[model samples]
Target: MIQLYNVYKTYNNTPALVDISFIIKKGAFVFVTGPSGAGKSTLLKLLYRWENYDRGQVLVNGTNVGKIKFNRLWKLRRKIGVVFQDYKLLQRKTILENVAFVLEIVGADKKTIRFKAWEALKNVGLSHKKDAYPMELSGGEQQRVAIARALVNNPKILLADEPTGNLDPELASEILHLFEQANNEGTTVVFATHSQIILQEGNHAVITLKQGKIVDTRVVV
Candidate 1:
């Protein structure tokens, strides 16, 4: 679960998040939506502690995120998975290796790494392309690989920032389905997207933002 209370963040004295507060319960799927520079990405970064907040509190899974020590960030990050608009895959590494890289960073044994990496790729329906590099795959395939990498560790929370921004509608739908599947399996999902089609197609709770403030929170049917 995630909770934010009066969270305020500013960059160069310019507000990025203003008086933000929300609670995302376990096993919930929520969408964060807004126009460009609306602070959707900034909010996600705060959850993961990738960016520090100037004021207020952010609690993720009962841990005070803002108070965590820098060297201990991996402890917090290991419980969460994040995906970006860009695939962020290593161009030089094979798909399997990219997923396995996460496990390696977590210090998993070699055998476990191989098995989990393979299973993750299979979950994304990309096991057959495990040997391919990022450049060798299509845009959707690359994004699927990115999702596989994000899920390989079986994170408690999944944060996706505009993951469908670059793909066509059909491919975006497929990617969204994968997120839904993860949510069904009990991963709390917070997906940030600006696509109206995506918002209209979902029945999940939505949090709308503008100019760094929350404007609406409701279920889109």
Candidate 2:
């Protein structure tokens, strides 16, 4: 679960998020939506502690995120997964290696890492490309690999920031289905997207923002 109370964030005296507040229940899937510069990305960053808010509180799974010591951030991040618009895959590493790197940093044994990494790729339907470098894959394939890497950790929460931004509608829909599958398996999902087609197709709760403030919260029917 995630909660934010009276949260405000500013960058160089400019507001990015103003008086934001909300609660996302455990295992729930929610969409954070807004146009460019509407603070959707900022909000996700706050949840994962990638960026600290200038004021207010953020709690994730009962931990006071703002109060966590920098040295201990791994404890908080270990339970969360993030996928970006740009599939931030390691170019020099094979797709399998890119996913295994996450487990490596988390200190999993080599045997466990190999199994989990392979399973994750298989989940994303990319196991056939396990030995391929990122540059060799298509855009959708690259994004699938990123998703595999993100989920390999079995994270409690998944934060996807405009993850389908670059893809065509067909590819985007495929990517969205992957997120839905993860949500169905019980990982809390907070997907930030600006695509109206995506918003209209889902029945999940949506938090809309504009000019750094929450403008609407509704569950699409």
Candidate 3:
């Protein structure tokens, strides 16, 4: 569950988001689409409190993300998984360790960590490459590893920003399908992308933005 009420955010003297308001219910799959500089990244950052908002409220699972104390930020982040466009994998760590690192940070037991990490890799069709370092894999493989890392903890919410931007069409479709599977398994998903190819699957909410404002919101189905 995520809610934003009359949110406003500005950078320097320029505004990035203006009067944005919307609600995403639990288990919902939502897409945020817009042109370049439309504030899609800003919106996602606000949800995770990666960037401070000058005004308005952002509530994730009923807790105000912006108002949380610095000490408790991890408590909020642990429940949400984020996939940046860059993949952000640790080049030195093997894929399995990269995914397992999340569980380790959460202090999961060794057995549980190994099992969940393996399962996450299998979910992305990359269990065979679990021992490969990030640099040893192709672009798409690295992306899959990133997805495995993001989903390894079974997060309550998933935020992806241009996750498939650098992949080929088929690879992009494969990546998007992985996100759909994650959403179907009950993790709410909010993806931000400018790609129209993602619209081919039309059974979810789509929020269009322009100049940092919510220009439109519709259920694609």
> Which is better, 1 or 3, measured by TM-score?
1
Candidate 2 ranges beyond 4 A from true positions: none
Task: In angstroms, give how far residue 15 of model 1 lies from its true place.
Answer: 0.9
Model 3 alpha-carbon miss at residue 31, Å: 0.4
lDDT to native, each model:
0.96, 0.95, 0.92
Tens digits of per-residue lDDT for model 1, 33-77: 999999999999999999989888999999999999999999999
**Residue range 62-82, candidate 3, lDDT tens digits:** 999989988989999999999
**Is candidate 1 or 3 superior in lDDT?**
1
Model 3 C-alpha RMSD to native: 1.0
Residue lDDT tens for model 2, 1-221: 99999999999999999999999999999999999999999999998899999889999999999999899999999999999999999999999999999999999999999999999999999999899999999999999999999999999999999999999988999999999999999999999999998887767999999999999999644
TM-score of 2: 0.98
Worst lDDT window (10 residues) for model 1? 212-221
Model 2 residue 99 lDDT score: 100
TM-score of 3: 0.97
Segments of candidate 3 deviating more than 4 angstroms: none
